[model samples]
Target chain A: MFLPVSASLRQFARAVTADRLAGDELAGAITAENIRAGKPPAAAKADLFREFILKWREILDANSRPRPFSSAEYVRSLGPPPSEARLVLLLNDICGLSQRDIEYVLDPLSKPFAELLKEGRAVIARQREERKALIVEDEPLIAADLKDVLENMGVTVVGLARTADQGAREALKSAPDIVLADYNLDGQKTGVDAVIAFQDSHQCPVIFITGYPDDVLKGEDVEPDFVIVKPYRPEAVQAAVAHCLDTERFFAIDADSANGDL
Target chain B: MSNEKSSAPEKRVEKLQIMVADSELAMIDDWRFENRAASRSAAIRSLIYLGLELTKSDPDAAAKLLDQLDRA
Candidate 1:
């Protein structure tokens, strides 16, 4: 496969599986299997994605338990589990595949692509409209700025904490849809410590907006998927928040399945 | 004097086959009728061209679509 096509497939698989490792592994396995089978190279982008969808379905079937998958049992507050069609729509947003290409890949779709797109949009809009965020920054100006940006995106700022301890306390008091934390705090505990404190209970997405991205990335305690460096663009923040919110539910589902709690 | 005109040579267009659901076909037919397109091929061509034009104008069309979705 071509480099760009391979990368896009990896991304699409990641969005579908909601686990980076699983998604990458699945993509690699499929590519290797195709090569071993001596199949011709995919003639169109849709062909490659169709192969991925088959592999994903096989995994889902293998992992099927006696009890049917239910989102209510695990996290009722997060709303319903994302349907497969919704995930496809989300994948389109991430991969930027054309409508015709997507239709080809997900042929016999339970719902029309246009209708699914509309429904997915409404769901996302509602989620954003009611979304709440917690900002952990010692700098008063930065915290205020984050609040304003999130508010403009329709995300309510639940609380602002100057220290890790306070951040954790605020998070516990009111659960946030996502958390934006700075690396260094006013107190002994860095933002990493603060995130570690509540992440187990909360399981919300974390975006580290800090000058010391290296320190945060190299930390042994927690590994965040989204990190923005200092002097960030508001557009960057908005994009991160949108992506984090979009994938949070899917991640929760994956976690539940891993723990056999689903 | 002979009248002569110069222009780029026409390129050969290959025929590509695709599968569409019944609903999608109906959508195409509806669009063709509404726009008074000459044929299904014409309607499909116009739609594809429109989509390509939009993408060219705004590479972030998907992101913008998401924003629109949020509003919708």
Candidate 2:
């Protein structure tokens, strides 16, 4: 996603510390080359382009975009050039950092965000457990992980289905709290189809996660709480699940409460 | 401004840091690539906004709204 500020704020940053900006030639090179390549180029934010600022910009860009991992591994093969700026915000702009980037930065096993997600779940869980929770996954291991994670957070995994048919059957039976469906399943039917099928039986949120992002993830019928990418840190997964569950609670509380359970 | 920065409530919702994944997030170089269409994050954000909008006037009627949207 593009930032709120100037798109080419790269050069001004490096010039601040390096005591020298890349000069006109280098500035043109960076911006011109990027533009030539169909990528966004650096632009100064008005007078913010003091010499030092330009230096820092380059450095910031380097640190922020730190050469994107070259593949789907999402694992950074090299460390970034050292700098003392708040980098996470910049990392947010990093397009190809592996699924592990956030996890690596914040240990899901022990980070504050992890704790927050857990706490977040409890907040909603303590409320009424009105909706049935559904888990649709073909991978037994990941399914077990979700079940464990949800159960640990005190949100029931009402039912588990390995295929669209099985998930749809469960949906018909329980009408689920939310469906945590893997985007691509083992059978011919996809998570989108599963969501449509399940919704046909009942209305519930679907939270999907995938390793690859493509057209398959679309469809107006599915209002997923979070579409986590695959290789997501445990904390990220927990956070997404927590959100959909919470949405259900909020949805239930609407004054006219649909099921009259609100 | 300081207090605004300090006391300004974090946008974080409990348990869920965010509802959706990036609509465009997928594997680019190695990081998640966010697609142009409905990434999970994008969907979540939209859903949250939609949820807030719907619940404001008629929460119980949300199902009907969703139903309407589904039909629309």
Candidate 3:
């Protein structure tokens, strides 16, 4: 599909002209080189277009037979293109990509489809991990919003607590997979206090969200993956929760102890 | 999306992910070849997903379905 391209891409495509790439057509290697120089998304996509052409070329080569093909060979036969023609056809077929995008990011070379597909598979696997979490906020509406976010992603929210003592009790009893607590809670306890207390009984990860920024949290008593500043995006919260759950180098507190390891 | 749901509901085919050691993979390859069958990788993956789907039902029916599918 045609994608808009930035000028940066075209310059990179020009850089890789020394290769045996046909003068009549852009080379896939150009895409790879652009990525090497840190190409933009447009250029990266151009690379896929180049890759498809190359793969089709190879398939044509592998299917060729010297003699005229019999009817049996019809299914295997794909009319081959000389180098220049192949590039031209592919460009025409997958047009819409801006010249700049094709040049800088996806010149003619980029990661193979296999590698990109593998990366997608790994991302899917990462998103499926099981996690135990603690919700440390005192506000009912905010806490409930966070809970829905977690559940939609297939994570179980084990308990809800308004105060640090209550949070600590639920944390110790249920031993949630992770703790998500507000920086300031009702009465005497802060989210930081709840996190410390919960850690004493369980080894789940903790995340703190507060209205105030680094000007204050840098000094407070805290142990958490990240201190999420408030007025948050749900995407950011989900991402942080996903990261905390994925961080397995720590919490060697037995894989099956509270929440099973991803 | 509609076509996806219209498959044989009782024996729905779905994807399953499996990871095995190289040695185990070789053994599976050998088993598939000796049986004059296509690569069992797809079958294995399908069976795994099918088994999981069956288990999502009640325990008694799950056991029965698993047994019927020869996947217990």
Candidate 4:
């Protein structure tokens, strides 16, 4: 509830005084006058200060409002999302701010961006209890690490499978909320094959981990919910798992693309 | 202690002086008192800032000016 305009004006005044202030003669006279009036000459800058206030009385009056503006109120003023250029203009003309000031004040509070981020995080966090994951990696060490990461992020790791047949069998038995699969698996079956095998029966989101995702996932019949490229970061895996679990029928490609939706 | 203090970077500061008429000075005093400014120096600084702000061409330019002000 802070008054941004008033605070900015005060800050501006302080900065100007510290740097490029002029009118020394006026300041001297004011000091002399203060001395004659039995006041401390040390506080003699009064007249010069007064001069400044008088010069921009209209600006001061406009900024000195009883209630400071809220981000919600600002969002309401713009209604729908306007072009960035138009928004800049409105902030300057209506709010009496410079473009840089507008960016500092409004960018963090952008309705669409803030709302989408907040909703996404909240949705993912709230649904953590319902999410169960299956880790399908041929490498035992990698599968164990993946399971640890998934479990740390509040996902229940149902099982770990080293081959496509094992992954398909475990997915069917456990009915996992999401699948994390490495591209190359044992028995010459890729992770994409594992996902395709159980995708219809399980109908859960899949996150494909691969060194060569472009080569493996490009020609696939169905895309994954998310893709993590090797060597994977723990945070990246956690984020991908959360995102995939929260979104239903998620594919890495755009929803409008016909091939990605199956 | 002296060495530590001296190791800190020195801030560059400069002094400026300008002339104004008695009538102009009086007007400044009137405005400063009426507006309840913290000090005469504060009033002067505010006026100069406001003057520059008013001259901005449009919102975009004004915003850029503000950015410059922040940097300054």
Best by DockQ: 2
Q: For each candidate in the order shown, give its overall lDDT on alpha carbons.
A: 0.63, 0.46, 0.48, 0.51
Candidates arranged by lDDT, highest first = 1, 4, 3, 2
Question: What would the per-residue lDDT of candidate 4 be over residues A103-131, giving only the tens digit for each residue?
Answer: 45345444454343444334334436556
Clashing residue pairs in candidate 1 (N, C-alpha, C atoms within 3 angstroms): none
TM-score of chain B of each: 0.66, 0.33, 0.41, 0.61
Q: Score candidate 1 by DockQ.
A: 0.01
Give Cα distance to truth, residue A206, candidate 2, Å. 0.8
The lowest-lDDT stretch of 10 consecutive residues in candidate 4 chain A is A70-79
TM-score on alpha carbons, each prediction? 0.44, 0.42, 0.40, 0.40
Q: Alpha carbon lDDT of residue B62, candidate 1? A: 56
Please give, for residues A1-262, the per-residue lDDT of candidate 1 as tens digits. Answer: 1124665576555445444434454666576577668876563567788887776555444443422122111111222224655655544554456788788777767878888776655544444667889999999999999998888778999999999989999998889988999877876898888888998677677877767644543313375545566777775566557656655333433444222211
Which ranges of candidate 4 are over 4 A from the true structure? A1-127, A216-219, A250-262, B1-72
Best by lDDT: 1
Which residue runs does candidate 2 get wrong by more than 4 Å?
A1-131, A215-223, A248-255, A258-262, B1-72
lDDT of candidate model 3 versus the reference: 0.48
Query: Per-residue alpha-carbon lDDT of model 4 for B34-72, expressed as tens digits?
Result: 765434554665577665656664667777777998999
lDDT of 1 by residue, B28-65 (tens): 98997786543455467667766677778886985697
The reply for model 3, stretches above 4 Å from the true place, is: A1-130, A215-221, A251-261, B1-72
